[model samples]
Target: MPLSEHEQRMLEQMERALYAEDPKFATALEGSGLRTYTRRRVYQAVAGIVVGIALLMTGVIVPNVLWVSVVGFLVMLGCTLLAVTGWRKAPKPGEQPVSGSAGGSAHGRNRQRRSMMNRIEERWQRRRDEQGH
Candidate 1:
């Protein structure tokens, strides 16, 4: 559910207070755990894919290791699926996914997400301009 105006204001105030109290701690806490988890999952998938390639090469170089090659191919396929899914599910920078009924229908959610991405891109561009880069 979406927060009321008053609740949103209160939350904003609390966030400002927390930032003011300890900037370092706030910065440390800024990263989302979900993002970290998805990144790690994707990295692990890539590692698995590399291992699979090594196994496949070993199977090919060594004689009578057809089963090893088959296993390696399976591993590669599974890991590729995992990496793709993880990447798709990951939220874009500065995009907070709103869970539950607050997002309404699937189409509405997609529209909202698109708009959010646009906003994030705008902010990134503004920051880059500010930094003269």
Candidate 2:
């Protein structure tokens, strides 16, 4: 959902205050560099895999060029590894739901769902109170 004007203004004010207090820390929190690096790495890996496929096909078509296919296979393997590692290392954005102490069991999920529902109910109640007032 989009932020209300008042909420947006408050958020902007808080952001300005944060910037004034600690510009470097706020900038570091942006995290664009890590995202960009991960994207670039994945793209490069995909390109490498495509090139490897072409090489493999070429080697197979040509007689007595087994080395090309072997090299292509190795390249594909390396690129696959690179892509997997890059994706794994990338940080997930947004708030993650807290799991219960018992790990991610059905009970944990139920609790989380109930908490979210309670929050929604509280918000609805507050809105009703405000409208009534």
Candidate 3:
């Protein structure tokens, strides 16, 4: 269920309090926004497309060198795919929860830490198995 306006305000106030008390921890708890493709990603994709277009023009000017443009276009396409699909993959299951240390309820903090540790251990075990160590 969505938080009511009052609850949202309260949460915001709590976040501010946490930020005031400890900026480092608060910033970490703020977590990334839900949407994908940050401004940098979008800018990079735009730059890639522009470069590809430039390469295409260069290829057209030089006879029998269409591969330059083709490669550029492919790279541009790959960047576009990375900007779109690559950004949306959710955090793996049982990842850490976002809760400011000072603001989180006791049970919430415990659960979050436990989940985070479990994920770390699972990843470590996977690496060990893969390396035959």
Candidate 4:
């Protein structure tokens, strides 16, 4: 979901405050999104694999075209490897927990809430199981 205008303004204010309080820390946190190289790597890998398959097909159908298939296969292999490695290292897309005390407290509360809901669900299930209907 997109942020409301109010939320956007609030976030901007918070960011400004963070910058004012500690410019170094704020800068460190900035621009931490996934690197562009990783996206390119994935795209390259998929294209390589597709081209490789096409080349292999052509080589099989035409005489004296084995080299084309060989080159394609190598390209595909290299691209696949690059993509896999890049994707593995990329950060997941989501709001990361804030650093420091609030983060820990928020995480703890979330866990507690999950546990309570689980217990409630289990109790309801047990009651249903006990009933003949």
Candidate 5:
């Protein structure tokens, strides 16, 4: 079931409270932070790619070592790919969840999660109301 507006507000409030009470734990649960590509990291990646190319060349020149050259080439390709697009920006620990592009898979996933959360929240609200009565 979808959450009513009041219930959504309540949930958001609870989330804020949880974040306030245990920011460290909340951050940890948010998962690893994005790896910012620094100048040093770029340099290292370039060095690794160069080494891989050198190894590949050596393997190609050496008799009976075509496999070594293949491995080196694969390593070079992997490094290049990683350098180009290894990581994306993870959502900041305390920031609101970002909605994905309209009608995307991410939207679907978020919708499913929201509905499940609403079900849980409804149960909680029912118990609260019962206790108050």
Candidate 6:
């Protein structure tokens, strides 16, 4: 069944309220641009990994360059460790549901999110049809 116009308006209003009351939750619900994680961190981590790989390779190839190789290996190791830790610590898309109090496993939350998005998308399609657009 399709939602009536009034229901759609009500839903929009409720959504607005949800956003106003808890922006973090609202961002999670919307699924983008909500994370405070910096793009710079990700870029830096990637750069570090690249530098580390180069160092490790150089260390392995050079003749009579044991210390250089060791230095390169160490650089690579440090960069890799830093990148790995940063990646792990980074926030994921839609890290939480609007109602954070709800108890469920990560998989369950994902299902719930998928269902919510499907409903929202369906409503949007219905509206577009109604408008003859």
In TM-score terms, which candidate is top?
Answer: 2
Winner on lDDT between 4 and 5 is 4
Where does candidate 2 stray beyond 4 Å? 1-14, 88-133
Give lDDT tens digits, candidate 2, residues 1-133: 9999999999999999988999887776666766776788889999999999998998999999989999999999999999997776554442232333435555756998999999999999999999999
* lDDT, model 6, position 62: 80
The predicted structure with the larger TM-score, 1 or 2, is 2
Candidate 3 pairs with clashing backbones? none
What are the candidates' C-alpha RMSDs? 13.4, 10.4, 12.6, 10.1, 15.4, 13.8
lDDT of 6 at 5: 100
Q: What TM-score would candidate 6 get against the native? A: 0.41
Candidate 6, residues 1-133, lDDT tens digits: the string is 9999999999999999999899887867664432435354567767876776777677678877667667766776776777676556555666632234335455676998999999999999999999996
Clashes of 5: 0
Clashing pairs in 4: none
Specify the poorest-scoring 10-residue window by lDDT in model 4.
90-99
Better of 2 and 5 by TM-score: 2
> Per-residue alpha-carbon lDDT of model 5 for 68-132, expressed as tens digits?
89888988888777666433223445433334553664675799899999999999999999999
- 78: Cα error in model 3, Å: 1.1
Instruction: Give lDDT per model, in order.
Output: 0.81, 0.82, 0.71, 0.75, 0.72, 0.70
**Alpha-carbon deviation at 70 in model 4, angstroms:** 4.8
Q: Give the TM-score of candidate 4.
A: 0.49
lDDT of 4 by residue, 16-123 (tens): 999999987776566455545456667888888898888878877889989888887887787788788767645444324234555775676699899999999999
Q: Give me the displacement of residue 70 in model 1, in angstroms.
A: 1.6
Candidate 1 error regions (>4 Å):
1-29, 92-133
Model 1 pairs whose backbones collide: none
Candidate 4, backbone clash total = 0
**Candidate 3's TM-score:** 0.42
For model 1, state the Cα shift of residue 10 in Å: 26
